[model samples]
Target: MNQKQEIQEGLWDEEAAQTYDSNEGVFAPEVLRLTVDRLAALAGPGKALEFAIGTGRIGIPLAQRGVPVSGIEFSRPMVARLREKVDEARIPVVVGDMSEATAGEEGSYALVYLVFNTISNLLTQAEQVACFRNAARHLKPGGRFVIELWVPELRQLAPGLQAVAYQTTDEYFGIDRFDVVSQHVTSYHFHFGAGKEARLFRSPHRYIWPAELDLMAQLAGLELESRHSDWDGGEFTADSSSHVTVYRLPE
Candidate 1:
């Protein structure tokens, strides 16, 4: 495998891939439903290309919603799990890096979506910019490119602090350590089960600010259309934790 193929190796191993559908924190049905509704409406009768499709949590449902959906995913194990949900005919998946890969012809999809903060997986500003350009390349004129991302929440950080624990439960605890200079955050998830020792998983992400993402989109020939706090189109405010923003190619 090339270096790009190994990008998701340690994090997206078979064990983690298997747990995806069962993880309610990540795969809540209502979340997927709302996402599909919004993307389907934007897609209309045209096709969509999902970045990092990842077990089809969104792509499968979007395809089931009657919009043709294809995906570019880097993890083979995750794509294998997605294959169990839908066949290639229903949702064709290209196994490659979303930042640099294409599902088919360029300018073929009407909507290109990267949900669940997946763009952060790129791990660098340059990669994120390339991803935006790649998304724009796959869109037809006037097609939409949508992204869901968490706003950087650094207000909780005290001076000289580099890490914060944001989630705690009886069986789970989550923390993120930020590298201010690099704009990167490494998330650590700890899981405990009855009568079992704890397991920890570390996922590295490069978080981008909303304004930075807008500039990246602009560099890719896309114009910002709207920004919302959620799939329901609520207004985005300074206090909002996450956002769903849409950009469009010129007609």
Candidate 2:
């Protein structure tokens, strides 16, 4: 793949797409329930658009809740996996980059959401800002844009260390190598099986602080509405590991 394609799809190829949901840790029923619940409530009675809606993990359930959901995804294989669950007629998806792609009619959606730390996948500040603008372009005047991202745990790293272990188990391991100067992170995940070889997958990302993200929202004509530690609206605090933030376009 070329540089552009690499940036767009990253490591989400056919094999990754096929096995994406196999990680039951992320696909747990209770976890998705919270996500879909919050998204459905934010969507209200209007249409919703999801950026990088891989495998329709949330989109399928949101649509099942009677919300009209659309998506923008760059990986054809991921979309193909999504199609296995729901037809295109139910959840229309535009195959393109979330940073600049136009999905549905401009300003037609009541909600545009990017979840699961997917914004970091953009790999650049400019692309991340453009993603905000793209989400704004798809929203109605009062529409909301929501993002679920992990707070960088640089505090966990000892001085002079560039890597942090995010997960460690007998069956799997995950770590992030951070470049503080460039605000970039490369996540490496290793899956192990008994009597089988270990598998590795790594992807690059550009991490953004909440304050920086708010500035990007401002640049896109969106204002910070609410930020919580989770979908249940827990208070965000210094010790929080992840956040779900909401931004709104003025009416």
Q: Clashes per prediction?
A: 0, 0
Which portions of model 1 miss their true places by more than 4 Å? 1-7
Q: What lDDT score belongs to each candidate, Candidate 1 first?
A: 0.91, 0.94
How do the residues 101-206 of candidate 2 rate in per-residue lDDT, one tens digit apiece? 9988999999999999999998889999999999999999999999999999999999999999998999889999999999999999998987888999988889
lDDT, candidate 2, at 99: 97
Query: Could you tell me which residue pairs clash in candidate 1?
Result: none
TM-score winner: 2
Which residue pairs in candidate 2 have backbone atoms (N, alpha carbon, C) closer than 3 angstroms, thus clashing?
A: none
For each of the candidates, the C-alpha root-mean-square deviation to the true structure, in angstroms, is 1.3, 1.1
Across 1-251, the per-residue lDDT of candidate 1 in tens digits comes to 65544756877889988988888955777887788899999999999999999999888888888999999988889999999988999999999888899899999899999999999988878889999999999999999999999998798899999999988999999999999999989999999988878999898999999999999998999999999999988999999999999999999
